[model samples]
Structures are given as structure tokens and as C-alpha cells.
Target: MTNEPTIRSIIEQELERRGYSLSSFASRSGINRGTLSAILNGNPPKPIAIRQLDLMTEALEQPEGHFYPLYVNECVDSDQPNRRRVKAFLLRCAEVGQTECIQEVLDRIVENLSYIPMIFEIGEELYEKGLREESRLFYNVVIESEKYQHSERLAISHYRLFRLSLGDDAEANLIAATRFELYLYRLPEDYQLDGLLHLANAYLTLQKWVQTEIYSDELRNLAKMVYKNYERAYLQGKAFQFRAERNLVVYYGQGYVLKGIALQFQRRYEEIPEYIAGYADLSWFVGLNESGKEEVEKFKLFAKLNTYNLKVLLGDQSIIPEYIESVKKHPPEILPSLRVIVEASNIHNFFIDDILEQFNIDTGLYDRADNYYRLEVSKDRYLRLFYHLSVYYLRKKEFEEGISKILITLKIAISLKNYNYFMKLIPLFERYRSFATEGQLKEYETLLEGVIKDA
Candidate 1:
């Protein structure tokens, strides 16, 4: 006999036939009323809490496993050994760029492992093979595993990999943010600059800008404490770079403009030219006319005619074409200090366009209808490109594509735990949920719930 009704639909219809409201059923079944409502409304249930499912089945007067079968398919013996064999096959397929084979392996693993992190090693290997989708699935499984039992290091590693491969997603970002917060709480007295850097970056991505600033300030203070040690002092500069990038992204003109002034105050006068130049370049890119130009020029004067001793002192290539033009036009003898500045300036200017282009995303702002993608070489550029592309497709009603790209971008932001991007994309997800598949829609809902909970 052909089965006329699907299991889920039949369950809902049966409950209604028995004259049971969701609230009444939930009360009887010991399930949360809201959860029952979500399930009845066709939202995907979280993996059934077995004890709760048992309660549900008992209340319905159904045999155990009647509502949901314990086993949906038969196990087949593969020619190879156990789950490891399956993992290896998936890894090999991923290595060879056989995405379908990788997916097939994922399906088998999911069926077998019930979404556990036992497959994480294979997932990490697949990530190395450029199978980002498969890798993310595996990482997701790990992240959702029993909290106390899960490997924190493995989770962090997978998240870093996810960020490297897929950019960021809401899930990974939230996971990273939580981990960072926990690490800070657990290591509140730890003076490790590295941990502080991670926390700062996480906070920055989460748009906890004040927290980021606090962590960054703490890191700098720690760096200062150990500055007598050359190696420790170098670590401070590294932390500065870390914070500087986030500052650049958020505050734009003001951040870069002030950074130039700060470098001068630190008595790192030789290194000031490039900061000045970078500020100028960003100002021009963002249509901030004549903003940092005066400060940049002031640095340029000291940069000229300061050759030989300068290289040994600064060791950076900051003062290239921009400084060179200032020197050559003014007919000053280029000093060694100035040459290093010139070189650094050239390198900085070379990357300014690539950097600024990241924020110049097309969000269907110029035109409301057409959809197109502009490819820029820098990874940083990809964020804005995907952001705009998703918006473009979304505005044109090409939702699947829009959602796909948005998810991809979200994955990147999550990997980075970038709060700014996360906030930016949540609305997009809501706007496009109508066009997403039921499964995709559920994922969006779960993501939204997670964001809200975290906030």
C-alpha cells in the first residue's frame, strides 16, 4: 500500500484530529510550548531531544519511535573499514575537487554520526582541499556538539579555517565571539598579548567597539610594561597593526587621521611619513578633501635628505613616490632616513586603493534593479563585493542567488566574528527569507535566534 501522508504532516494532522491545540499538546508532551509552536508551524526542530521526544510519544499514546523512526535506512558494509574509511574517501574526493563525491561522503557521515564532531578531522582535511561547503558542514557539526565534551581548540581551528576558506558566517562568528569572551573571563589575569589580540579582534568584529578599544588599550599597556625587552616591544607594534586595521574599517577618516598624529607623538618621527601618507590616500579615496595632506607634507620635509643612518633606524619602506615627489620637486638631497620613508610610503600608497575599495560596496544604491558582480583581487575586497552582489541580486528578486552569496559573505564575517558585517547582513537575511528553501529559511531563523541570544 502506498503511503498517502508524509510523517511530519501526518503528525500535525493527527494532533489536530485529536482536538489538541499546540499549547495543550506541549503541556502534555513536556515540550516547550514555543518549540511545539515552531514545529507545528513547520520550523525545523532542533535535533530531537530524545528524552523530550520520548515524553512526546508517550503523551500521544504512540509506541516508542512511532512518531520518528529510529532507523530511516539500512546500513551497508563498505569495501573499506569504518567511518575513517568514509572520511578518507571524502578527503580524497575533496583533494581532487570532486565536490559531488565530497557531498556524498558528507551525507553518509551525517547519516552515520548524527552530526557529531568525529568527522572534524576529515572536515579540516576537506577544508584544505577547498571543499568549503563540506568543510563548513563538518565544522557546524562540531560546533553544535555537546558543549562540555567538544574540543575547544579544534573548534577554534575549524573556525579559523572557515574564516580563511569561506570568509565568515553568523554561526562561526558567534562561536568565535563566545569563545573569546570565555577565554578572557577564564584568563582575566593573563598578560599574554596574543590572547588579548584575539579578544580585541573578536570584539571588533562583534561591533563591541568599546570593548575592542579596551582590550587594545590593555594590550598596549602590557606591551609598554615589557618594552625594555626588544622582542616584547616588537609585539606591541604587531598589536598596533591589528587594532589599526579595525580602526581603519570603522572610523575611516578619523582613525587614519589620528593614527598619523599618534605615531609622531611616540617619537617614532621617521615612521610618521607613511602614516601621514596613508591618511591622505584614504582621505582622497573617501572624498575627504585636503584632510591629512598638511600633516603628511610636514613629515615629508624631515623625510627628505636623511639617507644612510635612517635605514638602520626605521627599517621600513614608507616614504616612496609621494615623499620622493615632495623631495625631488623641492630639490633636496634625499637622506637615508628619508629613503626608507620613501620606500615605505610607496608600499603604503600601493595598497591604499586595494584597502579603500573594500568599503565601496554597491548595495543596489545607484540603481534599484540590475544585478552584477565586480571582482577585485584582494580578499578584503571580496567582502564588499559579495555584500553588494547579494544586495543587487536581492533587489532584482534573484533570491536564491542572493541568499547564497549573502550566506557565503555571512560565513566569512562569522569566521572573522565581524560584528559590523553581522549586523549589516541580518536584515538582508530577513529580507530574503521568503525566497529561501524551507531548510534554508530554518537556518536563517536559527541564525537570527542565535544573534539575538548572543546580543
Candidate 2:
């Protein structure tokens, strides 16, 4: 059977069907219009009081069961005190961005220590408001609370979200790396490998290559230990191969990148090739080489090939067109991956118009392709592409086009719920909005409102 209609969606549809504006419905139900609007259109509402649901239901002439079922489940399925209250408080905070209200709700959770997930949920909203300091403090409180049992896995998961929210802050990276290390050490042997991988990544973010190397080595050993344990599955061989490939791509390739960065920082040019070679070998092993043994090498090669074009600008001769030429001669079947490699390698510098012409790619297709790559790869890439495109259009005096692209980029960044990206894009938007029309300006305002409310 299908799930019940969401209370908020139901209210929204019912209000629309009844030809009542939000203001009219608010007056009839005696619910605050702003609060009601937020509940219906913003983040999920906190568990509502039965009486409040009853009032909303009675006023709308709808069955109370529709609105109260979820609330009843919250009460009966758990022993946690004030779960309903905490949920309500969180929803309200999300709607209004009221830090004080949010803090009060969080304070109650801290006092009881029963709703740990709710704390993380609220922390995400706080992060949206650019309140990293407050979010970090709350995360720590949740971590320390005795009432809620914390697990390394949960902490690591939450830390990933926290990292995304805070961007690349060195202090935050250090803290995450430290926590991951402690978690891995304390974790049971059978469960420690995943934690080690996370720890290694955190270290990589902090540019602590030595620490990352240690964790990566541990993870590699752990993977070897688990390799023979799963042999009976129907696709066991393929699954094992896939897992091994993931390790090679993530640990070996990524580790080499870190090592290269570390070597560069230390001015150890003599050792750079070894790290770069490791990176290149792994990339080729993962099918980044066109003549690789894999039948579908093209897709893998394009997807995995790293570009050192930036290195060229820095006077590094490590990445050369001859390497790419070798791949193109024995091209893989994956056209998209090929395109990705071409774009990523900054091959655009040599053949921007030619690549566009050869592919017969329309502007829309180019935009979509760029979006797909950015989404699949990294937000930094997304931002970089958007910035490039915006500047291109702006220089050509296509102000509207530039502003539209930036606005879309901003919306995407906000939707990913990454505050760093949002923060980076906001000022750009504000500066360019002057070129927008009245309707476009209003639309931008509406989008911002939605982001703020949902955030």
C-alpha cells in the first residue's frame, strides 16, 4: 500500500482545492499565517500537538487521523520524553531561522539527551544560517551527552555532514581527522577499516599526507583481510573486482595526490614523479588508459584521467598532450567519459572551438554535460565551471545570461545544502542582480526565501 499523504502536502492541496489563500486559511483555522505557511512549504513540521492537529483538521473538515498518525507513531514507538516538543521546535526554527528558538529547543534536548538525530538535523539548519560556531558547539554537546549512546559510525557520518557545512576550515579538518583516528583505534577489528578510510580522507583534507598514508596503509591491509570472506555470492567475482577497483581509485590514486601535494609543499621535486607515477599507474589500472585490457576502457580512462594543466601554469612539465594523444589513439567506447577527460584536462585551451564543433554540442548540451560532470566529480569543479561561464558571458556583454547562470548555480549550491558554496555564491548573486529585471529580481527573492526557509 502507498504511504499516507504528508500532512503538509495534504493541507497545501486541500487549501488550494478549496480556493482559499494561505491568509484565508490561516484566519479560518486560527493558525498564524506565517507559521502555517512555513509548516506547509518549508522543512518537515515538528511533531504537532494532537490538539493543534485536531484544530487544523476540524477547521479544514478533514479527518484528524490524517494529521495525527505520524505524531501517534512518534509517541508510541519510543520512550524518549519530549520527542514531540523537540521535533516541533526544530521545524519552527527551520521555518524562521530564529537562532534563539533553535537554541532553546536544543537546550531541552541537551538536558534530556534523548534525541540525538534531531540534534544533527538541527545542526544542519544552523549550518545553513552560516552559524558554524554554534553548530560545532551543539555537535560537541551531542557527542558528550550520556543519555544518547554514540557510535563511531554515527559520529563519522555526522562529521561528513559537518565537514560539508563548514567547508575546508583547517581546525575542523584537524578535529575530524583526530576523531576518526580515535574511532578507528577503538572500533572492533572487523569494523575498523571503514573508519580508517574516513580518517585518511580527513587527514588528506588537512594536507597531513603522513597521517593519511598511515591510515591508507591500514585500510589496505584490512581490505586484504576481508577479501576471502565473501565467496559464495552469485556475482562474487564481479563484486570483489568492483570493491578492489574502488580501493585502488580511492586509496591509491587519492593517496598519491595527497603525497604529491605534500611533496610540492616541501619542495621535494625529485620525489614528485614517484607520487605522480603512482597516481598515473592507478589511473591507468582503473582503465584510464585507452589500450588498457578492459573492453570499456574509454569510459574509465576519461573518468579517471587527472589533468596537470594547472601544473603547466606553475611551470611543471609533468602533464603533456602526448599522454592524452596516446589514449585518444585507442579510445574507449564511452563518449561521455571521453568528453569528461577532454574537459577536465583543460584541453579546452588548445581546442575550445574545435572540441565544441567536433562534438556538435549545443550550448544547452554543454551546460548539461558540465553540470553532470560537476555533480559527479566535485562542487569546486561546478563552481569553477559556473564562474568561467559567467565571466565568459559577462565579458561578451550577455549580462542576463550571466546572471541567470549564476542564479541557477547558486540554487544548486544551496540545494546541495553546502553552506560554503552558498556563501561563496551569495555575494556574486548580489553583485549581478543589478543586471536583472523586476520579474527576475522578484524570482531571485523568492528563491532566496525558499532557501532560507528550507535551510
Best by TM-score: 2
Q: State the weakest 10-residue window (summed lDDT) of model 2.
A: 369-378
Per-residue error for 263 in candidate 2, Å, reads 4.9
Cα RMSD (Å) per model? 21.4, 14.1
Predicted model with the maximum lDDT? 2
Q: What digit string (tens of lDDT, one per residue) describes model 2 on residues 1-455?
A: 75876556676777888998978888888888887766666665554554566567778897534444344343333345566555664554444344554554455456654566667666656666776655664566666664424564355344534354434344555665565444455444444554565566565544466776677667656654453343333235444323222333344344455455445435455666665565454333322234333323323342244333234324433454444454344333223323333443342333233333344322323244323232222433444456445544555567898677667666655654545556766787687777887876887888889976874
How many residue pairs clash in model 2? Answer: 3
The global C-alpha lDDT for each of the candidates, from Candidate 1 onward, is 0.48, 0.52
Q: Candidate 2, after superposition: displacement of residue 161 in Å? A: 6.7
TM-score attained by model 1:
0.32
